[model samples]
Target: MQAYKLAEQALVGKRNADTVALAMYFVPQPVSRKDGFRRTVNIKANPMGFATGSNLNFDLGLPKLMAKAKPVFCEAFRLEGHYESKSGYPTTVSVQSDSDGDFKVVSMQRLFPNVSQDSLQQLHGELAQQYASAIKAGIAKLEMKTPRVELRFMHPIMIQGAGAGSDEASKLFQAHWQQGWMEFKGKNIGLLGAMKTVADHNKNSVPACKPQVLTLN
Candidate 1:
């Protein structure tokens, strides 16, 4: 599967590299049926405008970007590749690996220590409603037979293990994450599960999104 390949790639030069983060969404329909459902992966080396911290986070700018690029998916599978933050830094989320092939994420219920979870959930619900309205309007304008799309934002953490003494800090820091794609058929779905995380500055591992079939009607 795509997740397996991405995990392998993350470990290519850096052995300890384990976890990866991803943001899944939809893209514009392709030109032809032959192009519909074909998957692509894009590497983002530029830095993003998101703020960093212990938990996954997002910036006001991200939604603006999404609003500008309204994507819809009918049906789509997953794909993988290298990507980085818009700020030219590593992928957003980072964490410590509890064991091989398994990682923990900051629970959605506890994203911000100061804010109550109920309030955050309510806020996200409102946002999703607004996004859904916008996405519906956007998708309505597309031509029939426009294949669904899955636009992903990939963030992988490639760091040097403690005591390795590689002295290639710049090269390691220059390491990248991925943005990926996929497509299919449907009315288009929208769901917001998690925001990307910051680079694992403490040499901590990050988290990986398990491949899943997500559909929003």
Candidate 2:
């Protein structure tokens, strides 16, 4: 029994190593704020997904393993959310990886895409309706039926990797941490825990198995 349990744990670790990962340049957009409590919503739209099946050159993007973001729907359930572009950039936002080791900036680019004012106006109109519809329905998720017409025009910055070594990657990550630049949705979670949550979602196909507040201690 002991040997079997050990083997099982190792197997689980291996599976997570491949399926879980981190995002750079952009992260998940959590909608629905509260007075006190906070909830992380895993939406169904990511940069890679938007780029994929389209002519958009977001190849600096770490390709999303799945074709579509699967927001787990619930009636009493909170909203399923995904990532959105917060900043397009000449900044240091990078796609971090740890398959072989920790703190590797897998890819990045100097400049991210910038949206045009006309497109922003269009986005404002679409997003206004999008949020209003969700709020009116008393849910916190974007409806799939509605087209995200705005994104087609709003181009985000490109991220290209420089092929840094593990040590250099670790140093870069450390600098970000010291500067308080890195953020994880869960209060006490970090990169590894976040990926573990991703793996859990991949393994379990139920709402109960979703990634919630996690603490690494």
Q: Highest TM-score among the candidates is held by which one?
A: 2
Model 1: runs farther than 4 Å from truth?
Answer: 1-78, 81-115, 134-217
Against the correct fold, how does model 1 do in TM-score?
0.16
Q: Which stretches of candidate 2 lie over 4 Å from their true place?
A: 1-113, 137-217
Candidate 2 residues 145-178, lDDT tens each?
Answer: 2221221110011111221345544344334333
Q: Write the per-residue lDDT of candidate 1 for residues 111-211, one digit (tens) a residue.
A: 11113556545545554454443223222111222222122211222111211223342233223211211110111221111111112211244323323
Report lDDT per candidate. Answer: 0.26, 0.30
- For each candidate in turn, the TM-score is 0.16, 0.19
RMSD versus native structure for model 1: 23.4
